[model samples]
Every structure is written in C-alpha cells, then in structure tokens.
Target: AVRIVNKRGQFMQEAVPVGEGSMAAILGLDSDKIVEICRSVEAESGEAVQAVNFNCPGQVVIAGAVNPVNKAIEALKAAGAKRAVLLPVSAPFHSTLMQPAADRLAEVLAPIEIKDITIPVVANVTAQEVTSGEEIKKLLVKQAAMPVLWETSVRNMVAGGVDTFVEVGPGKVLTGFTKKIAKGMTALNVEDAESLEKTLAALGK
Candidate 1:
C-alpha cells in the first residue's frame, strides 16, 4: 500500500537466514504472546532469540534472541527444513541487539545530504505519512532500533483512500501482511508472471 522509492542506495535484498529459525504465523496471538513463546523456546535452547517482525494484528515473526535461535532451528529441522543455522547480519536485526546498529546509523545519517520528499512515503518508524525527506531519513535510522509499525502503516494507507493494495516485487509477504492488518481490504502481488497478469486484469476491472 506504501511506496517509498529507494533513495539512491537503499535496496531490498533477499532475506538472509532463509530457513534457519522456525517462524510460525501465530494467529490469535499478540506481540507479547509471541515474545513469550520466543522466550520459552530460547530458555529451552539456550539462545538469544526474540520476535523480529511485528507485522500484523495476530502474527509475530520470531528471530534470534541471544543464546542462539537453536531451538527454533530444531523445530525447523523437524518440519523438514533441509538446512538451518544462525543468521550472519552482525547483531540479530530487529532485536535489542541492533541498538548499536541504530546508533551507528544515526551517526551515518548526521552528515548525509537530505532532500525534501516529493511524494507521500509511509514511515516504518512512526507508522505515519512523512513528507519531509530529512524526517524520513531520521525515521529510517530509528527503525534500525525500533520495532516496525507495519500494521499502523497499512491502516493509514487504507484510511487515506488506498482501496487497492498492490505489492510490487518478489514474494507475497507484503500481500499477506495487508490481509492480516486490514481484513476487508483486498491485496494482490506482482511476484511472478502469472500473478502479474492476474493483478493487471484485476486493475482493468
């Protein structure tokens, strides 16, 4: 529903640690519940892992904590994952471990040139629409440490008259997120050729 053009350098790469930890869509559950589950698993596995992606109303994506994401890795193994291991992104992203990264990002942004935003861009930091490029940059740095406010962002998009949510790029992940956050709002993706055709056809209607 939101489109923030990657300022020259930002890029969306495939998520590393693809099948390492077990990430289940724990529906009918809140973020606190998911954090508890991650804690439970971490207690059993002696690893530092916690909920990473707070995507929607009832879903929470668990990632590494501290001890290790070994317990989740084991669960994935039992679920037929061919390979599983810890991720290699310095600190466990989205966790408190990234506080240092956030600090580093802040330092990096302090001297970077910032321009005004020409279009509406949804901010993951505040889950609000940000029109000032400087604010957008600041938000991006803060997002390195703060939790992603995807649900609120999606809600804002719907409230702002964006009836159709089109996720452009690979994967139906965002599309699924739109469904979870705004149940009545329809979501479509352009991940593959078939999906693109279907999306185009739907748009024509």
Candidate 2:
C-alpha cells in the first residue's frame, strides 16, 4: 500500500501552483511496470510524470502535472493495475515537479545549524545510514525532490539485525509495511495510550 503524507498547505504557502499537479497510487504493479506505464503516457501526451515512491514490493506512487498523472492512471488501470486512485494532494511532491520547492528548501536549510547524530539515521534518498551533519543536510534537501527508498531502507535495517520495529507515530502504516517487508518480524506501533500499553506488554516491560 502507498501512504501519502499531505503537505499541500505548506506547499501552497511555499508558492507551488494549485491544481496543476497531483499524485496517484498504482497498486499491483512492480516498479519497472509502473515506470513503463509512465513512460508510455509521457510519450503519448508529452507531459511529465514518473514514479516517485517505492513504498513496498507491489505498490508505487506517481506524481506530476495533473493531466499526465490522470493519463498515467488510466493507462495503468488498462495495463492491469488492481487499483489506481488519485490522492488528495495539492502538489506533486518527490517528483521532478518539486525541483523548485527543493531548491527553496535548500536555501531555508542553509542557515540552520545541524548537529551530528548520535545514532544512525537512514536517509530517504540514498537508503543508507548517514552520520555527518553536512551529509545529512544535503540529503534532506535532495530528498524533497527525490523518490523515497523506503523499501530498501527497511531491507537494510533487516540486514543489520533489526528484527523488531516500533513505530511511534499517529498511524500504524510503518508497522504494516514492516510486516510485508520482513515476514515473521515483530512489528508494533504506539499511536495512543492503549497502543502504548499493548506495545509495552508485547515487549515484556
């Protein structure tokens, strides 16, 4: 499943045009197939659209100009996609369409002081652990316009002996992804008081 983090309000405040862009979830298709479908649409309509998120094995998200995005969705559905639904978003994030936003974000981050992280943080763009503050800052800027490598990041964590995952957030999305990425791995989430108690009990604490 593809989960979208809506930042349209902030995007509009940052000067991204309204209604000119959109995002859609392409299910039941691998990355290569999704890319192929996007390419076909681009060739036919000459509009920019591409796969932006590799969320899991069989799910991906595409973003770009609204026309092209909708075109790709229709093509994907015709090409045998299980589902292709337009997401409620204001901007085409994580796609080349966001290059302007990414550039502005870089300027916004330039003045901020970033301290070195004590623990390894998997970067969204490279799907690798980044330590240096400088590298982290650069990656953060690039990540705004680059596809999120979430699946690869999870694989790296599993390879590094992370068999148990605790998602501390408002949703259980990551916990769900964890189960799909690594079968039999303990996956728990703490989103509220009740969930926190359940997680604590699961951890025998």
Candidate 3:
C-alpha cells in the first residue's frame, strides 16, 4: 500500500510545479472558521485553498496553490488563529490540485486484487469503519483529493471501546495527536528496539 501511494505521489508532484503549491497547519482555530477564511481568500486572490485535515479540535491543515495557501494563512491568523505555519512539502496534497493524480491512480488500482479485511479499518476519507476490500480501494483513490478526518476517526475508535493506540515506525507525532484527541487513552510508540521492548512490557506480553 505504501509503495503504491508513493508511486502515485510522483504524479501528484507533476500536477503542481515545485513552489507553486503548499500546505499549512492552523493551530487554535476551528475548522469551520478556517474553511470560511480560505474560501474568502480564494475568491479575492483567484487561487484555491481549503481546509484538508481536521487533525484535532482547534487544529486543522490547509493546502492548495502556494499563493492561496499563504493568503489563507494570513486570513486565518487575523481571524484569531494562534499560529499558522507552512509545511515542508513540495506539492499541495489532498487538494483539488491532486485530482489528476487521483484519476491516474484509479486506473493503476483497478487491476489489483484486494482481499477483504479481517480487522475493521478506519478510512481516512470517511472517518468510518470499513471492512470490505472494494470499499477500501475506492476510498484510497478518493483520499488523494479529499480532506482527512483524523480527529473524527480517532474519536470514533475511542467511542467504539478502543483504549490503546500503538504507533509503529519513525515518529511519535501521531501518538502526540492521539493524547490530545482523547484523554485517558493509552498512546504508545515503537520507533526503535528499546521502544518496542517497552511497548511489549507495557502490554504485559
């Protein structure tokens, strides 16, 4: 899955020339407020930007053409955002600018065989539990051009009785987000051999 997404990202980069597109994180602002500011900026600047990630309450990510994104950042700060910072990404991802890439990815995904999942997967596109393979494939394509409902997905999992979140791989960033998104939830990270051992010990394995 990672391989396919990385491959398709090449096409996404081509859709927007380097430095022409950008993304930013708006902290201490509501998503609705962020969206409204972005739209107003888009209308005035004749460029496009939108709120693309509802990371958690009071935090959202926006992405689009660089000019619009910069405009939106200023607008959001003026509207009471605590901070708005540009992200270190070459292209604006999960925005309408990625539609061309998503279309091409659909073609590449069409021939692949996808088996149904045994464990329910929370879809980033929908923030809902998905079990069927076909739905998963379709969502993957849509995710390229749609906002991520990360906050909603985490809330849904907690409400459904999930109490522990173990983030494996390079960073503990998601674990930090999990802690902020849900109080009293156990968040763990396994980024190295020591951390893996600690995680196992904590889980009583």
The top-ranked prediction according to TM-score is 3
Off by over 4 Å in 2: 1-15
Count backbone clashes in candidate 3. Answer: 0
Q: How many backbone clashes does candidate 2 have?
A: 0
- For candidate 2, the 10 contiguous residues with the lowest summed lDDT are 1-10
Q: How would the candidate models be sorted by TM-score, starting from the highest?
A: 3, 2, 1
Model 2 C-alpha lDDT per residue in residues 68-138, reported as the tens digit of each score: 99989988888889998789987887887777767776776678778898999989799899898999889
What lDDT tens digits, residue by residue, belong to model 3 across residues 66-132? 8889888888888999999899998888998899989989988999978999999999799999999
The TM-scores, one per candidate, come to 0.64, 0.89, 0.95
Off by over 4 Å in 3: none
Question: Quick one: best lDDT, which candidate?
Answer: 3
Q: How many backbone clashes does candidate 1 have?
A: 9
Which stretches of model 1 miss by more than 4 angstroms? Answer: 1-27, 32-50, 68-91, 192-194
Q: For residues 12-126, what per-residue lDDT tens digits would candidate 1 score against the true structure?
A: 1122233332333334455675566567777876655776667887655555543356565455445444444344443455554555655656666677767887788888767
Candidate 1 accuracy as TM-score? 0.64
Judged by whole-model lDDT over C-alpha atoms, candidate 1 comes out at 0.64
> What TM-score number comes out for model 3?
0.95
Q: Residue 116 error for model 3, in Å?
A: 1.3
